[model samples]
Target: MSDSFGFGQRFTPDEMASIRKSLRDEARFGSEFIGRLKRVAKRIPFAEDLLAAWVCTRDPSTPRRVKLTLLAALGYFVLPLDAIPDVMPLLGFTDDAAVIAAALAAVAGSITQQHRDKAKEMLADL
Candidate 1:
């Protein structure tokens, strides 16, 4: 069967490779997200949304494909190098923010109030 109900349509080889890389980098996201968040929290305007996405990703009830998409964006955020190197002033995290915004828009319905609340709580503690 060629059906991909839960995951949408099948990916081409290059797309599949990127997905695989995202999955492989999930641990990196988990490990680096907090530290990176702390470092750039003051600079990033969307920290709450980012934390909500992280909360959604960790929720057992979240769909796998949603998790995959969020992880891909989160993974990109933590990468040492990306479309725009993240060390530059002002423009550094624009690409990361764009990627994250796209992922959140794609899975907006899946991110619940509970996730948002948890994210807010985390932000308060931070």
Candidate 2:
């Protein structure tokens, strides 16, 4: 897992690490954030993929760039406005899904079955 995510081209490992921690910390206590996600996870088409990203972020083996990319994608999921607003009923989550898809593609090899299993566990707990 030495390969860079290639998408997080702007941030160094230290910067990415900081950003990852910041986003994780924000979501850890962010009832509003996690609450919103939990409510939408069932309805969102790519929710599982995004959950994989979230789990991948916490993985010690995930590359820094991948972690940063995952954090950015997940962080975007919590925002009110992005490429498309998350309030448009059905189409709102499309952009978020696309972002996750792209992130997943960028780090194709990094997102392992382990991440998917962890994601499923967390989503079930949610």
Candidate 3:
């Protein structure tokens, strides 16, 4: 009955509420998070490679649904439109990070050494 099987135990109702609140507040903190992500993203040379690794690791071997979910989450980051506009303050990027983290956790097994290596290579600049 619990979400223990996925993403380190599904978030509790309270946790989910907190996450929602964080998203709401992110409008005020969006800029900071976006800046952080930009800094991090900039360090990685092969962002696509890391993303490929995430896809391979997180989704089931034949994961159509999970793939869609990941794509949607990724789109949320790249797209300008969302519940909280990316231009907001510190919290703007919290949701993006949370979603990406959740997706990564979901497919942790798929993220192999190769993926990590690629990420490391890209991030070496940082």
Candidate 4:
């Protein structure tokens, strides 16, 4: 939990605590954001399976940078940390969505077309 993001930089416990507090404060704003995430999740045809596959591939075979980026993205999804506090009402989750979308876009090349196809298939059901 004390890992650094880059050269000579680290997130202290205090910073992490502040982040957690911010996330908690933003939770109310997260409802709409969560809804948007659900919609995006729905769009992925085989989202559950693809997510499982992505998780299963957490071995050395996966590129370190890719893994890190994915972890960051997944964290954005599951973690409460956000640039825009989710407590701000309608616009609160906008930034969160943008961040997650950017993260997903960055790693899109790593995801196989088959995964996309499957996700699309699953999304159609929603």
Candidate 5:
């Protein structure tokens, strides 16, 4: 059972692993991920969900496979070029929101209450 999703698309295990690695490396590189979320939350609908997905990436208990799925989603969020450009009014973040929703659905079981709480905490600060 592969946990890959993107606009009804799917990914192979190898691809999933690569995405996860990239996400991990990005996080290690800096805290810009959070900063980006904070900076865009007001304009990005489903921003809370994105924040929750991010928190899941940091938790020790989140399964590797689940993390991979979420990482890909986050990767999409951070990508400047995507299915839709992030500059159009009222439409910029829709693709990002969909990816986040798909990622959350793929790993809903692993997204615990603790993750949501932490996301809320972050959102409060934003």
Candidate 6:
């Protein structure tokens, strides 16, 4: 993707590579998120929040920065490894929750009621 952030900002090769990876990860985020969510839905209290963020991130009307932020958080959530491993029983998702919390705080208003409603519906069906 040669898409620019529209600020004329230039990225180093490594940064560009990371951007490409983020795009790829974001592209696959929805399915991967759902698969993992189904397995861990009973554990995480923020499933609805995560789903709402995903809904907003996929919305074309959402701002690029908000989508990027949500995608980065979602990317971290789906990763097999991170600052804390996801295999721990009770503490596994703290890092994921913190990342999601910060992302939601940064883009709080971007997640509209429609997105939240969709999230609720998705959660009900889960």
Instruction: Give the winner by TM-score.
Output: 1
Clashes of 1: 0
TM-score, structure 5 vs. true: 0.82
Better of 1 and 6 by lDDT: 1
TM-score of the candidate numbered 4? 0.44
lDDT of 4 by residue, 52-115 (tens): 3344234455555555555444446555557776567666657655655665665555666665
| Superposed Cα deviation of residue 66, candidate 6 (Å) | 0.7
Q: After superposition, how far is residue 73 of candidate 3 from its true place, in Å?
A: 2.0
Measured by C-alpha RMSD in angstroms, how accurate is candidate 1?
2.9
Please identify model 2 stretches exceeding 4 Å from their true place: 1-33
Q: TM-scores of the models, in the given order?
A: 0.83, 0.76, 0.48, 0.44, 0.82, 0.83
For candidate 1, write residues 93-122 as lDDT tens digits: 899999999888878889999999999999
lDDT of 5 by residue, 1-126 (tens): 333422344567788676856666664523666767878888766877888888898888877767767878888887768888888888888888888887788778788888889988989898
lDDT score for candidate 2 against the true structure? 0.75
Evaluated at residue 39, the lDDT of candidate 3 is 61
Instruction: Extract clashing residue pairs from model 6.
Output: none
The lDDT of model 6 is 0.82
lDDT value, residue 62 of candidate 6: 91
* Alpha-carbon lDDT, every model: 0.83, 0.75, 0.52, 0.51, 0.77, 0.82
Report, for all candidates in order, the number of backbone clashes. 0, 0, 16, 8, 0, 0
lDDT of 3 by residue, 1-126 (tens): 433235435446785564454445434434543444456575433354435544343435635434444544554565556666656766666667666777666765656666576556545553
Better of 2 and 4 by TM-score: 2
* Residue range 1-126, candidate 6, lDDT tens digits: 333434334446785576458568444767788899889887899999999998998899998767877887888898788888889987899999999998898778789999999999999999
For the record, the alpha-carbon RMSD of candidate 4 to the native fold, in angstroms, is 8.1
RMSD of 6: 4.4
Q: Give the range of the ten consecutive residues with the poorest summed lDDT in model 1.
A: 1-10
Residue pairs in candidate 5 whose N, alpha carbon or C atoms collide under 3 angstroms: none
